[model samples]
Target: MSTAAPKTPKLPVTVDKPTPYNFDLGLLLANDPNPVSVPRTTTASSDPSILESHLANVARDGAQVLINQLLTTCAITSTSSGVLLSLPHAQTPLPREKPVPAPKPETKWSAFAKRRGIKPKTREQRRNLQYDEATGEFGRKWGYQGANKAGQDDAIIEVKFNSKKEAERKEGTTVRGDKRREIREKVKRNERRMRKNQRHSEGRK
Candidate 1:
């Protein structure tokens, strides 16, 4: 037997209404209100005569305004009629100055050399001069000509001048050589690292 086809049900559609906006009507009415007169009255007490009280009130008002101005601009206050202002005064005591010691007179290099028993001709003698690197000492070499002719074999030379001052003269040459060697080694290491990185990167690519 043939079954009857089922009837299709129709779906109902719904329409939404726009929402209503809320507003205050009292604010609008207040905005349109008429201006009214306000009654004036004395802020002070009624014990004294009206004329004297009025004058006193005016004086009090003027004084209060002046005090307010002073308090705003400067650190000040008032009790009755007298004005009071606070000022910051330094309380640090002055440092006492002690008498300076007299400056020492300057001595000339030639006078200093002479005081150290260094003769001008002996001081100018450079042929016998030799530097001992092991002891960082400078003296006349044995069997050398000029100043070493005294026949003293191992006499310790007395250093009168500053060794550091003499060392500073040769410091520039020695330091430059060491720095140049260091920079060259650093550049070589950098080049080796760059070559190694280049090879690794080339393999990856």
Candidate 2:
């Protein structure tokens, strides 16, 4: 009767240490590089398969290493992946400079007329007649005699023959109508001679 109900068994109370919990949480946050996910199997059924799968990764790692080494040698930070690893692009070799154009030659006729203080047309007229070399005087051709204008002074201008035409004339070639007929006659004569020679040779054989 006076005895109190058996003292209820004391339940153990656990007081978690705040310092340890905080320390553990801080350690986890400090060590984590990225959010954790469920770990996946890295090993493959075959060694070759595993190696092949990682080959590209290995190559990328090697490239990164090479880039880092180069950057370190140059005393630069290798943090940025976008930075060029080698020499910066040279100003695309300024398109090979185009050669400058050469100056044009001065016209001889214009220059001569200017020097002589005469108009171009007058100089041209002076050059048309055959001028005497020693006297520097000119005379009209036989067919053109008495045909010059009244104020023209009957002065003969020196005419320079075209080199090609002069050469043709020297070769005894005629350029106009009657000369062409003469050439045709000469060709006919040569053909006749050749036919006669052939006939004579055939008769002898």
Candidate 3:
């Protein structure tokens, strides 16, 4: 008597416009309507090598079914490169595995400006550059190593009796000393703001 050939399980490919496996197309996946009960046989489970081969063959067949179904369901479009397949969006959203990132803490100045609706100057709009004769090049007017931002640093600062009046300058303070003091005060203020911002960020965590 001839023995009957062992029957193989055939998985039904999801022919719907948007397959639940839409996001996993890279793996060439086929969707199973009954996810909890996949139609599988235990014929090769006793042999390790046979089981591995069985799984591989099953994957290959599933991939083929998915490819055939996608070809039939998707819209075909002609492009300069070649034919294109327009796949539909999956009705269900994929589950997120990770938590959303925390927002960065803002600086004191940034927070104040945001509340006041004051837009900061852009790179092109800021007027903080000038020609430094010593360097023979244009540089930032107020940053470190900037053009003689403090006229006091110049070899000969041409001072006019009606020249620019420096703020908080003593009655008898010279131009060079007044300029230096103003720069020092600004540096101290920046340091204080930095410390305050750091404390605020730490408190957020």
Candidate 4:
């Protein structure tokens, strides 16, 4: 048996037509069946006075539009009675008041507490604390008045200072330095993994 190759079909070609163009001067001179001459009367638009009046009206309208925009921008309004009212009054500048000094304990025991470097447990607790000017004292409004004591409630807290050896012993008994270092290393590894993942995601984008 003989093997034969199939023939490929030819594609049709496309041809573009040339554009037509024509010009005539006679079209410009052709007169209309009902021709109207340019106005010459005083009241006509072509009249110098009338033209000037139209221009003035346009200028006035433009000025009124600009004025309205200006009024709107300034937060102002004009009523039907011509009385101007501010839509939203301009904000008044805040007064530059004197700076109030921070509250400090005045009494002897409270002063000792201050010397011992006692600090508030929380920001809210510090603010809510009341000061007695007459007796030179401070008081707490609510909760364990024990810590800040005399400042708000005259309740006092006893805090003991630990020696360096005592602190080290306590740290060893609870959270050891080696354990803390291990935790820190683990956290750093997790952070590195997250950074690597983030970089991969960014590269994909």
Candidate 5:
């Protein structure tokens, strides 16, 4: 007995309801107005080949709808390669299949700021600039040849002591190198804090 070969399934060019898509929101984005993935579960079968064919048909239908939508709404451009369609911003907001991730924990500085109600300062403010009384000009507070390190430029620095204990310890001597040491220590502390925050964040992840 001779058996006839099964013919390949013909992909339908016209979809019944036409899968909704927006060319504006960029590529690979086809938004279904009324998602029926739940209803589709009712037709589930044990046959892998049948399931695969159904999926392929559904995908092909969706693609055709998307292509149709693109051709109608988008601005068409022709090139040596082929045709190009410029998609616009998508209006539809779609939710992800998975749950949204939790917010990252704040760093120590940010937490402290929030607790103290401390506002962020701009770079162009008083902290970033210093008024040079000698030249009567506003100069950078920190950086190369900045006002912060003006003590280093002078041959003899006049040191000021806040406490009686500090005065007794220094004995009214010039301490030009002390400022540099303090800055180095401050920078080291900040680096250590950043490293600790990084480790904490990785641990949470």
Candidate 6:
């Protein structure tokens, strides 16, 4: 018996008409005020091809809407128009500004006067006097009146005023032997008064 040649089955032609993109950006933008609120979930059985196509459609629709708005607002006639438009992929919120530090409280002479119970004298008023207004003490201001040693060689110069003899030896050009003794005595008196004042302030505190 003669057998007919086996016929091959012809494959079904799938004429895929381009899938129409039906996404509307205005509908989504109007319904959802916050883009962050949009759901980004996908079903377990969802086809990747369909999902990809849908996302592409959504992007195209959103881009078209943005282009239309920009063109209308900017009055751009063509791509060659002077307006150069750009859009950022994502926007980051600005960081909260650091709280401005409170201004430091000013130190005023009134506060000093209140603490010492006396009106504070200006530097010019107390220039030539050894006076403590709080203690009502007056004495001679003792110190060497030598020329400033800025121009002298500092390595060779020695300044010592621990005693009358040392003061006379160090700055003999400014103070003589008797003057050096007076200065030494004045310094000791000032130191004793300073210690007493410090103790009184501590007690007050």
- Cα lDDT tens digits, model 5, 1-205, are 9999999888676677644444433645665564444224535654466667766766777788777777777899999999887888656677899999998877766778999999888765547777889999988878877776777767876655585535666654446666787788889998987998877756643
- Identify the runs in model 2 with alpha carbons over 4 angstroms from their true place: 1-50, 75-164, 167-205
Cα lDDT listed for each candidate: 0.48, 0.45, 0.67, 0.48, 0.71, 0.48
Candidate 4 local lDDT, 1-205, one digit each (tens): 9878888865223212142212111221111232223446767654677667655654454444444444445444567888653433334434668766766425444455679998646876557667767657865543465232223322453334775544666433432244445556878998876666555545542
TM-score of each: 0.16, 0.19, 0.42, 0.17, 0.40, 0.23
Off by over 4 Å in 4: 1-46, 75-205
Q: Model 6, 87-118: lDDT tens per residue?
A: 32333334668976876443443446778898
lDDT of 3 by residue, 1-205 (tens): 9999999877565433333443334344456542332335575455577767766655665666678867877788999999988777655456789988888887777788999999988987788877778779888877786654656676776666655565545688887676678778989999987898878767742
Best lDDT among the predictions, by candidate number: 5
Backbone clashes per model, in order? Answer: 0, 3, 0, 10, 3, 0
> How far out, in Å, is residue 65 in model 2?
1.1
Error of 3 at 142 (Å): 14
> Which runs of model 5 end up more than 4 angstroms from their true locations?
1-104, 159-174, 200-205
What lDDT is obtained when candidate 3 is compared to the true structure? Answer: 0.67
lDDT of 1 by residue, 122-193 (tens): 555645667767668776664334243332333453444766745665634443244345556878998876
Per the 3 Å backbone cut-off, how many clashing residue pairs does candidate 3 have? 0
- Per-candidate alpha-carbon RMSD to the true structure: 37.2, 31.4, 10.3, 32.5, 13.0, 20.6
Predicted model with the maximum TM-score:
3
Query: Candidate 1: lDDT of 62?
Result: 40
Q: Model 6 off-target regions past 4 Å?
A: 1-117, 127-176
